[model samples]
Target: MTKEIFDDIFGKGNSNWQKVSFLRRCFFNDNGITVNWRANTPLIKLWKQAKDLDEFKVLLKKDKDAQKLQFTHEWLKTADKDYDQYLASIIKETATMQYDVWSDAGSVKVGNAQFSFLISHNNGDGHAIAAVFKNEKDFISSPMKFITSVEGTFNIYDYDCGQNVIVTLNGRYDVYVYCGITCFVKK
Candidate 1:
C-alpha cells in the first residue's frame, strides 16, 4: 500500500511496477526487455508503433545507433553516482516479460506477481512497502471480473511481503489499483 518502498510512486498511470514485479529487476535502457522506465524526460522513441509486447520489443530495439547508450557502471562515471544506479536500476526492471500463473521460479508471472524483492530491518522488524503495477488478466473464471497483476519490488520491505499480498482488483476503464495495509501480520 505504501509507494515509499523504493521511493518510487505507485498509483494510477504508473507503469514501471509491471516490468520489475513481473520479470527481473536488472533492466536495460536500449530495450524494454531489461526494463521500461519512462525518463522524467522522455528518451528515444520506439519505431513500428508497437502496442503489444512483441511489437514493443521490436520497437525498443530499433534505432540503436541513434543516441548515447548507458550501462550501470558507465552511467556512474558521470558526476552523479547515486542517480546513475537509480536510472540503471529502472532500466534493468523494464526487460522482464509478462505472463500468468504462479510458478516456483524462472517465470515472469507471480500468479499475482513476484517482482524480485529485497528487505531491510533498519527501520524495524515490521515491513515497509513500495509496489508498482505491471499487468492485468481479465476473464470469466472463478476469480471472475478484472484481475490485475503488477510487478514491483520491496527493496526495503520484507522478502515475504510480496507473498502475503492480498490483492483486490477494482473494475475501471483505465489502469486502477488500491494500496494500503488491508491487514497486518503479528510476527
Candidate 2:
C-alpha cells in the first residue's frame, strides 16, 4: 500500500535507499494521502483564525502569494548542500503535512545524542498508542492513551541515545534508528 503511493508521489527513477526510505515515510499515515513535516525552524504561520483545512489552505495560498511565505520548501531544494540534499528535501517536505500517520528518515553523527519526533493523531476516536524505538538498544512504549484529540496535530518525542540516533516516525509504531548522518531505515 505505502510502496505504491510512494511510487506515485515520487516516480521510480534513481533508486537511492535513503531517498526511497524518506519518500516512503511520507505516506505512512493511516489514510496514506498526507505528508507532515516539521521544519528545523518554524516557517510561515497558517492563518490561525481560519476554522478548517479548507480555510487554512485558502489562507496558506494567500500568505504564500503575499510573499509572506518563509523558507518553506527551500530546505527541500537546498538543505545544507554539503550533506545529502536529496534525502533532506523529502524529509523536510514530509514533516510539513497534517496526517494521522507519517514518519521520517534521517541519520545522526557519531557523537550525536538524540533524535526528536513529532507524533500526532488527527482522528477524534480514541486509539491506543503503540511506538517502538529500535537501534543498538531498542524500546517500545505502547498503549499510551490519548483521551482527546486536540487542535495541534503533532507532539514531540525524543530518543536519548549513546552512539548516534537517526530517523523518527510520528506515531507509536516500530521504526529504526542508526549511526551515521544518513543511515535511518524503517523496518
**Tens digit per residue, CA lDDT, model 2, 21-103:** 44334323222234333322122134234554345434433442322222222222223332233322233332222122222
Q: Which residues of candidate 2, in runs, are more than 4 Å off?
A: 1-83, 96-171, 178-187
Best by the TM-score measure: 1
Q: Write the per-residue lDDT of candidate 1 for residues 1-187, one digit (tens) a residue.
A: 1123222422223476563332223223433333344333112233223344344333333333311233222322332434323333332343122112122321211223434432221223232222233332211011112223323322212233345433323222221211111111111
The lDDT per prediction is: 0.27, 0.28
TM-score of 2: 0.17
RMSD (Å) per prediction: 18.8, 18.0
Quick one: RMSD of model 2? 18.0
Q: TM-score each candidate.
A: 0.18, 0.17
